[model samples]
Target chain A: MAALSWLEWNPTSFNINNPWTWSPGSDKKVCFVTTGATAPFTALIESVLKPSSIEALRNQGYTHLLIQYGTAKDVFSSCAGAAQCNTRKDSRREALTIDGIDFFPEGLKTQFKLVQQSKGLVISHAGSGSILEALRYQVPLLVVPNTGLLDNHQEELAVAMERSNYLVRGDVKDLAPAIQKSEDFKDKMTQFPPITSGGHRETKSFADIMDETMGFLD
Target chain B: MPSPPPLSALYSLSFLLALLTTLLVAASLRLLAILPTTHTSAPLAAARRKHPHATRLLIVLGSGGHTHEMLYLLRALDPAKYTHRTYVVGAGDAFSAQRAVEFEREVEGRERERARARGDGDGDGDIEKRKPKTEMETETQAQRDQPTPPRTLRTGPEAYNIATIPRARHIHQPLLTTPLTALSTLLYSFPPLLSSPPLLPAQPPQTPYEAAAADLPDLILTNGPATGVLVVLAALVLKFFDVRGAQSRGMCKTVYVESFARVRTLSLSGRCLVWVVDRFVVQWEELEGRGGRAEFWGVLV
Candidate 1:
């Protein structure tokens, strides 16, 4: 139930329900961050919007920072001002357009697509739904698990996915290192839903197992 | 007479206790006999002659992550093989139910396109029949170019039904009252497990989907959610009593797939039903042979 609530959360962001309204320019590189919607990870919003993390993105040629802040609007706004100020002080290039959304209510498909098209990076909370969606776009993903969660499944999954080279794992306290690593991770990441999983052993797809269990030989 | 009985060893309280213990042990043995073991179950299923007819597949959709992975695992679902589908969702979970409808529509759309391609007379019927791109690549081009033999098409709204049951335990519910709510959910699961209503009652089953709806599901597929565990329990009760010859007829065969999110350990629901389910599957290699017999078939989703 907590998982499904992401779709029903109220649209409290300044941007309208249509995400395309505040579109980034075609040439701008976007770095998208999605915290959990039902139980908003305020710490993630704070960390990603930290001055050092924003500086890391700017150093990597990023032009936009879009955060799906969930219910942490106050945290987003508080750090967003300082982050923008820091970017403005060094004006060699265009300022990073910083924005926040409480939730999409539908999905983050448009955001993922935008990141894919821009050759940008996606930093998401280590929820399987977001990880699976982000990986489908074949874009570089940095998954940060909330250490505050009672169960450590988020950390366990993030570590395992990283071991398989599917995504990079980030610490909630410091995301700059992981953000910097995303640039090199794109080419080395494994194609997800792997074609040849389980090594030399015969690997059957889910459909094959269904047919086998039913004894449908054909 | 009462005084005499008090002194007799034959009428002692210890003897009565022993009788009760023996009965309890016997009941447990019977229960274990009915539960399927992986080694014996698969071979028995494979030994059976192929039906090649109407088959009903029941799928349990959990909230969020489970539903997402369940749909991906079923991406190559062949409607022509499993003719009818029954999707079980928790009450108030409109998202999962809506996703089920959307999935069916996608199946219907694909089938329509497949039929149209066959009608175009381009000799691409076999190509259209194949679903997975990886599997298609392995077959010779000549084999794929051959015309596919016509089969019954099972797609659209009437071919499937979405059954919703109340949540077994609401979030933050008091632990003391969980059993009562879970029991109610178990009771509600019986109707869908028994048999789905035929598409049209007056007429005999004309389509494979209609025939399947009138019969018990041949398979119950779950991805180890709370609601799914209870549904499997209800099916186990049916098997225990051989209701409607469910056990003898091989209906309600349970398969529990551990979520892909669980790389090393099983989820709570998976831990509960691992031994009970006929086929327990885990995605990660580290989890293989868990619960004595969990299967690993690569990353399914």
Candidate 2:
């Protein structure tokens, strides 16, 4: 059975051999990606984000796609070394890694480019830093919030962002539908004026009150 | 018998001595009775008037018996002027069913009787005959209406109600243990201390006022010190001396309804004694003393 499954599998792995080789296409589609480090990845992957979503998208005639595995190494490892290509194994799923992406360190690059020369939507686990980055890029964002973390603060943040029309939010169960509806989702993004930083000034009035009380005691 | 030693002279001397002794005893009794006992009436009255339209007035008492007295007083008040809100706080489960229920039933029954009495206006003979039948009907109705009495006597807004103050169920347990423990501790610890006579400081003799002042700290600590060791000491002392009369320290409040016309005179007589018991008798007197009606509403502690 194992040999038969391997014969049916065909894996195509991409390698980033040189920097500046891949440039972003004019389509301007991007995805900001994160998976909550503290959340249950097994449940998210198996139960919520059913592996059928990626296969369905590929069958729909979309060639270029970006998958950001985030910092959840256990979840990323769970997707590696399968007998059948693109088919996840319950036993050896913990060793999976993204095939074509460069594992660059933070602050090394502010932008990302693809070898396929295609602009695509950004999909990420709901994290504030990732959301802010997507917003700065002016790309339509699809955020899947980790409900298992921190009293569901991410869910609240997702709702607030939805109200502002900055991102589209969904749970892992609805991730495939969310990805398919990304084109229709772009019209809902609200336009906000750019904001400047560093305008706050501090006053020493509280210090004066403390000094006066001390002086009275003296 | 030598003419009985001049009977008239002997009789006069004996009568004179008897009269002198009687006068001295009367004078001493008067002095004891008039020792200028302080009253809390003025402060309490002022507090009541200041919050006349209080919407809810919680009369928290330690037991069912005190709650009964408070209910009686509230019923006597002009209901129109102040809709009374009363609660009995600290009654035990047994007393809650027995005394508290009985008191409430009686108060309600009396109100019904008073309502009936107002309509029954006839000759003395008619009133006498009709009154007994009316009272009997009220008793029967009360029994039927209140098959089982509630544990709490609450009168206020349905949302916010106060529970009565709780009376100590274990009142005697503490009394029994306190003196025994004190005596045992002293007995156990005293042997070694006898070697140093000058180590402990001498306690000064205190006047009654000073003693009472000293007791205030303990009173504050215990919250209800009157019912504890103090009551035990008082009872023992009274029993030893074989003293009786008005031995109760009456906690009375006299509310001088300035606009007396607003008050129901008939209701007032049953609950409150109308006689003025001297202004000086009250702890804090308020008349026109403070020069303002709003400012000197009443004294409250």
Candidate 3:
């Protein structure tokens, strides 16, 4: 019995048998770009990493870069043969360059490792899964809303996290300044509450509610 | 001059009262159907207290935010307390299963660490033998082997597994196809689930449904999704109409928690389940009663 969904394709599951490791001799700090699974984030990607913007980030000390370009083919056509990164399926980190900036289109099979290994900032579209993963590692995040989405809920989540100061929102057009700002925000980001801040489902109270309601009804 | 009430209005009022009376009677009968019958034979309450069994939680995870929020909620819960947990996820929702498995591994890893610290077993040697030999793992493993490790272990894992229910309506499919698909899902979802063994506390379940009913789960938890709707509805049907003693175990309460993404109102899925679930939890206070009944609380994620 297969779960055939009418919606988006679920990426084939991959097992990470080995734990994440810190890459030795990786002196350059990296900035990672991910547009999420559904929407085409090519426009947002172009806005953030314009030739001029990449230069600005380089000037700010982000030496290495990676991109999870889901359906954003046109944006990186210039870097067509860009070496792919390790996907859970193809666990190889093939580094390639676009406009002289390292872009990994194959996507990393080991994402947590990549997130932890990244020494610079993570620029991501405002999807909750992406946001949560970034926040989990206390990584410096700059969330850019995918304005093309049907609902504006992602915008709401970004604003909430922004209010909480967990991550900064970046304007796609003027991202050089945002790249510079990630360093300052990274330090402040530590002050945000740990994501494990909710209480367990209290069973006794629930049982009590049921008992009381039944009693009232009786 | 005072005008007399219209004859048409009076007729309509009488019709409305009759309908209301019928609905109330039907509701009472439904509730009565699920309630436990006569406790006179024995002190079942006292017996229950003296030998209380741990609750088994069946968590239904939707894709994306639903899984995210459910994970946070589970994080706060004590794994040892819930010895048996079944996570029902949408089919082909590999992401949800992946995340669920990842969470369990993290918890299991932490538990192993804590057990080692207490000198419970020769875990140090076992951990060494079990450590991955991959090129990437060696660097981290070596660091972790140091007298002081940078990471702390997380707890909160017991016995839990993921089950799949077909997506009631495939996304991008014709909208009208949903009801028929949902009907098929309803027929098979619960009976098979009901028959499946509890697997923990190591009790033999008779006629899976009876076994499930005997150890009736305290809660049927879900964060709104199309698949979740099928599950909650299936659970309600079982609770309302027991095939193998759902009523005796007390109706397994359904809790529909709205996604954290919805700041001001319930999603369509949440709206649909609100009519039947025991507790409708919203992450934002502003969403309370916006569409139907709901309980206001802060964000879960």
Q: Pick the candidate with the highest lDDT.
A: 1
Check candidate 3 and list the clashing pairs.
Answer: A6-B170, A6-B171, A86-A92, A86-A109, A87-A109, A88-A109, B195-B208
Q: What order do you get sorting by lDDT, best first?
A: 1, 3, 2
DockQ computed for model 1 against the true two-chain complex using alpha carbons: 0.58
* Residue B52 Cα positional deviation in candidate 3, in Å, after optimal superposition: 5.6
DockQ of 3: 0.16
Minimum summed lDDT over a 10-residue window in model 2 chain B is located at B216-225
Tens digits of lDDT, candidate 1, B72-100: 88999999888889999999888899899
- Residue-level lDDT tens digits of model 3 in A153-184: 88887877787677898776678787777878
Model 2 per-residue lDDT tens digits across residues B117-219: 4333222344345655767777746854764422122222321223332233334456656565434333422221111111123754233222221111110
Error of 2 at A175 (Å): 1.1
Tell me, by TM-score, which candidate is best: 1
Q: How would you encode candidate 2's per-residue C-alpha lDDT over A25-53 as one tens digit per residue? A: 44222232444332433334432224565
Q: What is the lDDT of residue B195 in candidate 1?
A: 83
lDDT of candidate 2 vs native? Answer: 0.36
Instruction: For model 2, report DockQ.
Output: 0.00
Task: Indicate the residue-level lDDT of A157 in model 1.
Answer: 88
Where does candidate 3 chain B have its weakest 10-residue lDDT segment?
B39-48
